[model samples]
Target: MSPLHLLQFFLCSVCIHMFSIFTYLVYYYDLFTSSHEAQEKYDFIIVGSGTAGSLIADRLLKETNYTFIVLEAGGKGHPFHDIPAFGPLLHRSVFDWHYETVPQENACFAMENSKCKQTQGKILGGSSKLNNMIHVRGNVSHYVDWFHGKYTKEYIEEHFNYIESNIYPLRNIQYDSQLSDAVLDAAKQLGFNELNHQNSLGFQKSLLTQNQGKRWTTSDNFDTSKYVLTNALVEKLIIKNNKCLGVQINYPKKVKLFAEKAVIISAGTFNSPKLLQLSGIGPAELLKSLNISVVKELPVGKNLQDHVGTGLDLVLFDTSQSVGMFDMMNFFNLYKYFVNGVGPLTTPGCEVVGFVSTKNETIPNIQFMVLPVGITADRGSHLRKSLGIADFVWDNYFSKLFEKYTTTFFPLILHPKSIGEVKIKSQDPNLPPLIDPKYLSHPEDLKTLVDGIKMLTKLLETDAMKTIGAHLNKNHFPGCEEYDLFSDLYLECYVKHLTLSSYHPIGTCSMGTDASQSVVDLTFAVFGIDNLYVVDGSVLPTLPSGNINAAIAMMANIFIENTINQFNLKTNQHMCSRNISFEELFLNVCPVR
Candidate 1:
């Protein structure tokens, strides 16, 4: 080859290398720069820019002329957060809140100091950015039971339809694993209906909150024109004479922001109540104990609920046939994912889901997720460490099973009977809330979980599962050696030691028509405070029978629609009255002091 030809090839190579470097820089810049500085005031001030806050801002900006500001406590999420398989990997990183429950008497027996680890997202998208992207609307019966007398079925249907239209498209993607197939076949043999989407019931491949193999967080879908203050922590609501004016934010410095129309707290279940209590709106006695003046007497953090379940590890004899975390982390797999956006990286690791009823025929009390790979017992592994599993707990029950290809059956109790509470440990706003989920405190919850374990064990005995050579490890847990393996007593002991949170906490600040039973009224306003509202999972009256993200998004959409309708009504009324001044119209609508 001539020197001229070789020089040409070298020039092309240099151009390709420069282009790759430029692409990476652009991606990093976009990923890290998703925050805007806080303004002095706006029409609406939304706290906690998680799932609901993002959607609310998008709808308000698009549908109305109102200007809004969203305050997020964490910075922009990492680019890896968009990878579906990295769902669990984001925890304990800067993205996760890393909140843990106070010591529990009835549950989390295997955890360090009897405290279960609670993970919440602190990034721009909130918990949605870090959550397993399983999109489920829950059973219709749950909605009917919770809102039957309160809301008409037509009203509920309208909200659900709106969510289906706007949010991530829900669809079941096929996996190549034989383990997923076996689980589905076992469900069919057990007489469960095959449902592949949100509107139906029974066992099916789960739908994910992904768009074309990428995790679609609320931040990704939010309108960019709206203002958002990242790394800004809301300390308290600015209330005067039973009316909310704005919020006091701490973005490494003190800043007071005013909202002309209303202040909405879209903080998740735990933080929402904590913020309310800090602002002197909660149970009067609790507020008094904290030495804060009582602004409103209501149950701010009374009914904390979450999905609790026992995870059973089943080892597969064929390790070569299954994919694990190690296999997915290699350079070849990374190249495949970067080039094609398809591989193990495209899945949330929860491929199949089954909803079942142990007692009530219409309502599904138990929900199961089938994970294809075995969870690690050491903190060295990214998946296990990110899950915040106690080191001792893993060593005692799961260390031995780490040698083979493993599949875990997560049997979650959908509607847990055990009710817990979130309370303020101190008056300081910077401190985390005292989260006591009190899992399995109710006797029925324990019995229901034990029944679920037995049901799964039965499923494992089926011919489909047998074809995959699935078998329970049967290794004795630390505190369960007294009873025989697979016995009810043994399983109950195992469950108490191994039950973990499904990360779907809700109902801290419940919404209802009656003020005595709820913190927020039917219109989502604080019972005694004016110009204040809450639009998040905290407003959920009861835990839905599936993943709470979709339901929370639906609730936010409905709330935004209501706000828009109210705004339009006021605007039309003002237009009809030519003599009405702008100030007078504002007072008539907001009435803020």
Candidate 2:
């Protein structure tokens, strides 16, 4: 290396270290400065100030006169959370819930101890804080199926519009590199057209949950900071006579908080069900086994689904065609990012995304997400550890590709057939739930993934890819050497060994009209349990065709409007002679006394 290049590296190192110190200072500052005073009661008590919880609370505070409190298990946000490129680094950090699945029967073969590491944000924004920020509205048909056609396309689109306008508008990245262009061209070569946000198929630059090169999380929509109590974990619901009351929070000291109207659980997929189970609202047998009095017998943690994908890295012969650490950390890129808020650092790694169908061309089954930087680009540093890649696999397979110009393509199974469940182990709210995603357990799911791999291989054979000199990294995966390289058996083995979650887990606390098959009703209220609702990804009855975040926001928005209208209707129905709110009306004029 030249002296000037060495000097540039040193300067970049200093800037990163200084920024790290600043972020730490900011974290500590918020930790000490924030207030955590709990009121005796509220009109509504929201547990888990994640994506849905934050949006619901904010909307309630802004649109209605209802009194509510948001309880978040995690602490305040950091500066690092704002940077798009710094997303992967946030995994397994203080912000993440840091969950790991139990050793699986049919999948996660090559992960540490055969356990797949699940990353969920424990921070205010929840998983949105740790995701790639890909903003896919998903296919309209999926929404139709979710609401069972009761909600029209226009109604759903209106809600989506409301959310997009109020929370975070969808936007594409400012710049596209040569690799991005190549990916797009290759998709065109395969006869794929450009797809808009509403459409499900074709190639397009991914819409992101960002503004001006910064990540826009659900927490950013919250203006009612005083009502939000961070670091306050909801141990269980304070239920009485099968009617929901409030919550019992544990922030080192047990504090009982009453909710006059309802208690909403928006604690993502895993925690929402886990919280329900802990409060004796899950399967009767599980509650009986745990010796807890059952509040309601419902399948609180079944029907778990996620968009699982396996990555294939392509090593480029020409180094300039792909991005590496040096390209991202240089003085020029830093200047462009910090001062102008535009550069590679603005990307969450995925630059181009395409949707393709393995079985049906019209309905896409596989989503192709391309990242400019390779997983091994960081040289066994953060990315490998974040994914929980085994040390042996890294040393043997990925270590050779360090600093090599590469692009990683992930072909995600858009609609997985395999269903899993989340269950409570010992009725402990602090202990992580037993998450069994059961990825690829269904024969169809494995077949779909294999077909996705085949599609990706086909994309590589396009003339566009050849121009960039992109070739599949042929190094045999440690455990998949028994089969011939590039063969179907070898690819399947590679997929099983190197399965990576798209981090979009949903449907644990599913919603439907039938109580036998669902936890929450169409209104998001828990079946057989009044005044208790779930409004997170947990309530999704099935996985959406694309990224799940946009659909979640739309669902929560509908819930908020419906709930507000319901609350208002109740207030009007119970009107008394004295002019007062619903809570006061209930307390003062009971039985016309």
Candidate 3:
């Protein structure tokens, strides 16, 4: 409050504001300057520039002689995308696809029209550009089952390490908060142990896909100037004689770019399935209804899964105990962040994370994210609109806590029993798909989420929480006022009304040994299609124990490695079959070590 301090604050505010404007200008400049005609053909054609797509392009360019082109539907990324705290601000912005699910019968009860906003990144880095950048490498068993024993724990670990070394190593949040410390203490008080790096259960500071104070994306690992084509919206796959040979792009101008070797679809969970269905490679009945010719009869948009969770707001008696949005974005924090590369701005919303199990302690069913700021942190400015929360619910419930100092926790169901699917609304590639996660359709999924809520309520009663004077916000939710507040029925009603997607969508195009049930095989090749592959989250058969970005990167790494090995194997077989001396073979073609 002193004169010197006030003067410094004003100067810092001006500098930071100008810096933000500079980032925006830079982004637009890249968008305008980066558009040119792509090459006529490539060794491989990638349909997206998201987590999997970006990694695949970077790896292929660096590890092989093959040339590839990445077709992205979005524009270049902004520098704000590198700041962890600014993630939520990008949700409904131009950087996001802003897809929404259809009205649900059993869940998302309180949102507007009973629809949940599914925010997918439309920027160059894809969802990684807008996501919180939480780096969770989930349990190894998931890979074993999803790949049908083709990838073991050791193999998964090796590829995970490769991704870390190549892209960005995981780092803990540089900023510390009283709320994070209290959550950790409460977990210990409740008999939960600290989690090891490899364990999927228990409490620990979240490892993020960040280094220093900046976020890292798969796209950052490569040179976008040469490989990526921004604003290149792929309309459909160019298939001939049941083989995918190229893609038809509708952006910039209508053009066809062929693939010499293969066509890989890495356009995340929703768009990958949408692209396939548009190109005549999905369910027969759906294709027929739309009057589109069916290229393959296999299922393309079946078996959708996401980590569904609900927010729990806790108001603290002492304002200093919680870091409000103002406190985090103040001049002091901004100054520290810019000068020292460390501060509250480094927070990815969730500071400390915990995993708990209602059935067994070892296998956690719930993943708890400890957010230092409350849902009302922005006073319903951006969060409300970004989440597409109905105005009535916001006015009745969240608006009441606008001035309160609070912390919000998100308890996500690590694995849900409910299953849904993504289908094309029509044959049009420009339209967003019909995504119905069908959350809580299975009775067990609802019961399990309610159990997770109860566990969090217990954490509020812990002595550590008492020191911070933490208590659940008692304001009655708009549609859930019939049941007694804090009661089981009331919590269940609250959950149904306030359900949220953790942004971890997967399993729309699953892989398996059985062609009848899966879309891709062990080699990630399309079930019946030649030289076509799906190497993204869509191919994951089930949900992992935590955030799935790490798993997606691992899949891309393993796929490229497998492709290289296969090529080498074919070359070896062809050469060895001939009656040639080992010396001659080594001297001419295959070199000896």
C-alpha lDDT values of all predictions = 0.78, 0.82, 0.83
TM-score of 1: 0.89
Runs in model 2 lying further than 4 Å from the true structure = 1-29, 312-317, 576-593
List, residue by residue over 1-593, the lDDT tens digit for candidate 2. 34644564466456555655665676667667777688998999988877788889889988998999998888777756678877776788777888988887777787787788899988878888888888887887778888888899889989888888888856787765788888889999998888885566799887888877888877787564777888888999878888888889886589999999899999999999999999989899989999988989999899999999887464444566535666677789878988888888888778888899997668898988888777755555566777788888877887666445667788898888999999999977889999999989998888888898888878889999998887888888898898999798998888888888888999999999998899998889998887899999999998888888888889988999998988786675566545666676567443344
Better-scoring candidate (lDDT), 1 or 3:
3
lDDT of 1: 0.78
**What tens-digit string does per-residue lDDT give for candidate 1 at 229-252?**
777889999999999999998866
In candidate 1, what residue range of length 10 has the lowest lDDT sum?
A: 377-386
What are the TM-scores, per candidate, against the unseen true structure? 0.89, 0.92, 0.93
Report the number of the highest-lDDT candidate: 3
List pairs with backbone clashes in candidate 3: 110-497
Clashing pairs in 1: none
* RMSD of model 1 against the true structure: 8.0
Superposition error at 415 for model 2 (Å): 1.2
**Cα-based lDDT at residue 412, candidate 2:** 91
